[model samples]
Target: MSEAVEPSEWQPDWLSELVNRSTRSAILSTPFTSDQTEGHLPAPSEQQNDPISSGNSANASQPPLADSESTHIFDYREETRLPVTPSGERSVRRTLKGIHLFVRIEILYHNAPRSSNQMITVNATLGTGLYWRGGQILELGGPLAVLVSFLVVGLLSWAVMQCITEMLCIWPIPGALSVYVSQFVDEELGITVGITYWFTYSMSFSTLVATSAAEFNFWRGINDSRTIQGVVIYFLIPLILVLLNTMRIQIYGWLEVATGSLKIFFLIFIIIALIAINLGAGSKESLHYGAENWGSPTDFDRDAADNWVISLLMSISIATFAYVGVEVVSSSVLEAKSPNLSKGGGNPFKFSAIYIPVFATVAYCLSGVLGTLDIAWNHPHLPRLSWLPPDLNKDDKSPSRAAFVVIALASNIPGLDDTFNAFLVFTCLSCAATNLYVASRTLFGLTSRLEGGEGRRWYLRVLASFGKTDGRQVPLRAMIFSAVAFWWFVEVLSEMASVSVLHVWACECLAFIRFYRCIYQHREYLERENIALVQRWSVKNYSDYPYRSYGQPLLAYLALSGCIFVLLVANGAALWNGFHLLPFLASYLTVIVFIGIWILLKIFRSAPWSFVDLSQPKRVAEIFRHLHDIRLGGTDSTEDISEG
Candidate 1:
């Protein structure tokens, strides 16, 4: 059967009450702004041009009259009070209940195109996607697969994220990408990108949770299922989506920047600790064991290189999780404090450009050293190192009780074991937080597009209970929701860890495939939009673009390809040995589930035009605006397309 389907072609449900609820909620609860001062603002008669006043009414009973001051839609006094400022000060000044209705309608429901900077903030403050990918790597990728998967998926994730960001500013939330694209080029492309990203990110998160639990067993000796925690995290996923989305753009942006900082610290500490331990264990212990201990003699056969390549792909897949944050950075560009924009000057793109590489490099180094040490330490019997090389003469013992148990073998400081254990706990917790953040945003984005009713007053009320100053913005809601989703994902993955590795690999393989396809689909948009490009370059400029295979995309492609190949090889290996395929069969079933979801999206839920549907309405407007300004005979000065 054919897999392709037209996008965003769903018929409007005339009889559906749910549709009305979503529409009412969405239209009623648009985040609003006041262009005038309270009280100082003239009556409706004096300020007929006011956008806020034009849209809302202070009194519905009052009849329209030439001198409309008596019926001025918005009271200047109530509207001008600044909502809780971003500086974190709470204004206790309260208005009468009578004026409150006007303020709520005029201020809270003021639906307007937000500044690009504000949009960027919303993208950045929601930082769940980053850690979600990281944990996936730990779970889905094995030692051999980590590096390659990291490089491939990382770049793709970044590009896909940028594509989503560009699409977002065009329509904002509540509309699907297909709807936005339909406003510009066509609906087919919009549905194309929409279904692509939704499936890619969601499936990616799901596979990661499953894989992480399995991977945890490789290092720690605890009962594999019980030892791993946080499967219950995904339940909170729905809530996080709502909260972060409940606010205006600016609030969301600050939240991302702050959370990213915290994430960076945890990542750094782990990198540093892993490095210190690696460095502390020098070649002095090289005499104790030969290379065969880490892998069998058969492992070094000519096929080892192919196996290694596959392993690298798996690693890249795992590491791709770390790169998840880069997309948020790309999305933040609109809200980025551009020097030209009056509101702010910090660009998340710039931060992520530098931040991603630095983080990746640190992680790369940490993984290599840690992986090598792990291979070495996992030997049958060897003296565990105490801040030094392993002593071959000492009794052999595996520090499998806990990852921190390795630290106990190294240091004798008081509570050193506890301290190390605490760090490990913190790492897991951080991972959980990051996972929640990513899952919630993705789900919220999905829900906002899918749901017709926005549930406005209730949403605003939710934000208010948390003491919202102006009663708009739900950062807390988003956070809590994300946490719940994270919990759910963790629970699913942990429970399934006992399943065979091949099964985990299949789900991961499908996820990686979807992720790559999503990025590939957006290549044209990124190039045309020149969303973040500073210069123009041809495919020939990069060795990896089309033919040469050393650069980013090529490396990523090769890695993904290798994953599929190796998965087959691993499965074949088991079959050749006459081993059971129960685990493999189970995993195959999971992959089948994803395939089903994909089928439904392609046939039933796709947006109008695939490529054009990728762009939102506002983005379409922007593109046409720029295109209109271009002189027919003359060349446009700006080049679009940036490094992934």
Candidate 2:
């Protein structure tokens, strides 16, 4: 079961036809640089370097020479690109000098796709998702269930991250979930996964913006016009993000560093402030954390979670949402700096990825403990601020603030509270910007994949073209498109955001499982070639992979099981207690849409559901380039571990 049976000629007939197709050139298209995910057959000149052919024309199993067309290959070791100077622009050297010192690093933007630091921070920020986690405290009747949710989410995020890291190292391509799944499984399945991923992040533009605006409004006086201010804030922030992103990735990276620092600082501040407040270090009402008048009573009679196992499942759903963007790191492989090199030799994401998740776990853990305590809505004090709205009332409404209760705690610090609260506003802005950037990149990758093939949708071609940079170093069209989608969702499909995000997380786990199976079959093919089991110099064998996943197949299985459970119960909010149709659809809409796309593609492409043969490895075997370093001038990197 560990390896699939070998196929005839060690390649499927269908693969040859696919390699000859024009669409093959479109493979592995990237958002930052122009990499797309397509399959192709190499030319005769190229085959001379292919290990299987031994640089000779007499090899029996080599593919036919590809057409005389130019193709770009992404070298995991490094990236190289010509300056994207606009037509009739100044000389490249002159252009560099004219650009600001900060933006001059634009050369590296295309040369080295992702730096380790950027990857780590981006991963952590995605995981932190600063404001989204707070939406649950109000109706989570099961305090115990919420408490367990923190641990469950942490483990699940680890599993998913491992799956992505392993696959990206082996395949080393963009479109992340899309690229890996398509190469390992059915192309349609890959598209389904990619589109879902695209939708999840793209929709966040409006969702994150709207959420940030709401959080910002919480601090304003009741006399302020909340509606007008919210609309203005929502529109204003996205504009800043879009402008910043359209410039260059370095600009984007700097922003991430700045915001990421702020995000981490604010996150720590919240945690510490909460602990201090609980200790009664500073408070107007003298309320004790979780004390009778200060905290909530842990009452099972008051919770559906206490009586029903299903209620705990609901709590798990909430936890899963909290961990949505952690996988953003996977997409960075194409542009990540020195992906082939380790940190110190390279960059920060490696360090940040580990701690960010830990911080998230602590935050969630503290949140669960704090949720059952004196949440803002149930706070025993604040009568002096009677002018505040009922929802913001210092007395009954204080407990609903849950993790945000730190703001009130800061109030006790006099000189420090308002400044800390202003930082919170900056934190929200940072979160919105980060989510928006991820969302745009994801859509760009997805649409690029769609641009290939004879019957490819016309609109997809236009969109794919839109994602391409016009020498500006960013995907402007894609960013604008994503922004529009976000605003539309915020205004119209607002309710669908929660369910859609949950569905995407579950799909991430499933895609990894598919890739795991694909690699096993790929190994069986190389076994017949008598290649070394773990040759980093060659990609013909499974162990030849630079970074082998830890506890995979097993971790994948464990994660897959957990994800399935979450996916099934994700709709519990509507169905468990009452079976409301809209809520059910909101939860399961992504699944329904995906299934429909799967069937439609199967019919059109004449590919059956069983096209992916688990027992025998096929189509995908052609994908692993045995040449290893054909573009690097006949050699692989000395560094074996590409990502941690």
Candidate 3:
């Protein structure tokens, strides 16, 4: 055998060596090169300026030098290029390149940023609804009424969550509500639902801001004057919310985590405090009043005086408001670090679906029971009492008169009312921020579907521009537009927010019916072809999906029927008592707006009025195949050929 050459002496010819060096260097620096990888290279200055990078550089061990000609060639190229530049500039460039290379490598190997793992879902769900509206629910019906209405709506909410979570798991997309409505139902309905949903969230945001301002005024004991409250609501609150939303989504997620944790702790503390007060804790006389204030289960204390049925029906509308933000979980799924159900460590969508309604129901039921026990339903200081003097109920009927606040005042504890009011303020602000986020995202989703080609109308192009995201992926323009559009109507839209929520839920229920119908039709089509084919094509069975909800089509049916009943009867008592223009308008305005949008789209854009056709087997098969592709993580395209 020939003698083996030394390792260092085995260099190839110049051409071969050059090719080898270029290939090796390219492979080593591929992650930092924009042409090679999808990720962009960070500027050298950015690496040097990053505090985390600087800290890591101070402690991290240096990487071993490459034992190849490629490294020496790269060094030689850099040395020759630097001779023309100043020594200081050359030194800085070299240092920055080194830091950048280190950082990019570390990021690729160790600490990639993940947006999905953030804790926004639960926090966004527990917004201003429960805290601000509890007293109102208590006043509409007694403690028993509160329990019934919450359970009724809570079950309805659970069904809606199930339907939404199942869809989101298989096809997580931004503006999910509108897209589902459009694809399963009709494009006209989808546009209406999207704009209506955006409007609803905007109104909710304003309502929360006003409520937060009212809470602040209550805490400061400035209930007599509207001046400070106006400033807080119109200027301060809106400005802060806009600023917060325009920042990175990660920052907003962290903020929600902090506020959401506070809300949870406060809920636990207040529940315990309520139990203690009922058991004679915090009372000087040691009086134990347990469940005495619940009164008759069918009592109609306000608005529906003689008819308990109407009172109960109307209370469902108020309770529905409390459950509105729960669907924010679905709206937020697209932003999650792992939208795929199987890829994430656990299914956050399912957890949110199960946790939110259960938590809201339990919390609302307990607070209702314990609150009415502390303060009678017919208490004199109740804000909405019919017999109360107009002057007494005038402007003083702010959050200071909330049932929990009234209970705290009667608890005889020092500073308890102030503390509770502070929590109320926190809840309102947190929710306002959430509402803004949801509204902006909805607008972004809506605008994204609009065509902005050269042939499109000017207004359409302008609208589509809102869909474009910044480098950080935040929809900055959409957020500003949403905030500016609704800020002026903060005080006026408070009453409309609850009714709008009903409209949104009704639309979602209708959308779920169509979604179920699509699946059923697809199954029927597959069964007719061949029984064996149904098993072969696993899309027919819900269990074969990545995430399957319990009690599917039947649950969807019940939810739709329940939603319809509530919509028809919601605020019916107000009209029956007498035709008050404001209540009637607030109750039916969203419906009118929904119809008007459909009509406008039809007239202008010639949009189709009917639901998507499900009769064609070939089309249905394609849709199912697309879903299968999604299940397999084989594609990232949000739209399919069937959408056209």
Model 3 residue runs over 4 Å out of place are 1-118, 220-233, 284-291, 295-297, 302-304, 339-346, 385-400, 490-492, 524-544, 622-644
TM-scores of the candidates are 0.46, 0.71, 0.74
| Model 3: colliding residue pairs | 116-336, 116-337
Better model by lDDT: candidate 1 vs candidate 2: 2
- What is the per-residue lDDT of model 1 for residues 1-644, given as tens digits with 9 covering 90 to 100? 32322211121211121212221222111212223222121333443332222222232211211111212211111111111111121111111111111111101111122222222222222222232333223222333343445555444433333333333322122222323333343333333333333333343344444433333443344324452334332233333444444454444434433443444454455455545544544333432222433343212112112444433443442343344333332212212221211111112122232233344444543443353343333332221112223435446554333332343345343454455444443333333333343333433332321212243335433433322123332234433443433334433343122122222222322332332344355555544543221011335323111111124344344544544544444323323323344433532443454445444434543322143322343343233222211111011001110100
TM-score: the better of candidates 1 and 2: 2
lDDT of the structure predicted as candidate 3: 0.56
Summing lDDT over every window of 10 consecutive residues in candidate 1, give the lowest-scoring window. 635-644
User: How many steric clashes between backbone atoms does each model show?
Assistant: 98, 37, 2
* All candidates in order of TM-score, best leading: 3, 2, 1
Backbone clash tally (model 3): 2
Q: Estimate the TM-score for candidate 1.
A: 0.46
The whole-model lDDT of each prediction reads: 0.31, 0.46, 0.56
lDDT of 2 by residue, 326-406 (tens): 666555433343332211111223322344456566766765565444344233321111112244323344423324534
Candidate 3 lDDT, tens digit per residue, 1-644?
A: 32322212111111011212222222211111111121222343343432112222232222211112221111111110001011110110101111111111100011113333224444455555566566666666766777888888888888877777666655555577876676566766767788888888788777777767666667555666577666756787789988998776545555665666667788778888777877776763324333445435445564444577666776777777777776775455545543222133124455555556676778777777777677766554454523222444345443336677777888888888888778778777776777788788888767643445455457766886776566556778888888877666733265666666666666666766766665566665655542211222365433324456668678877877777777667655556765666666666766677788778866555445567766766554444433322222211111111121
> What is model 1's C-alpha RMSD?
16.1
Say which candidate scores most in TM-score: 3
As a whole number from 0 to 100, the lDDT of residue 618 in candidate 2 is: 34
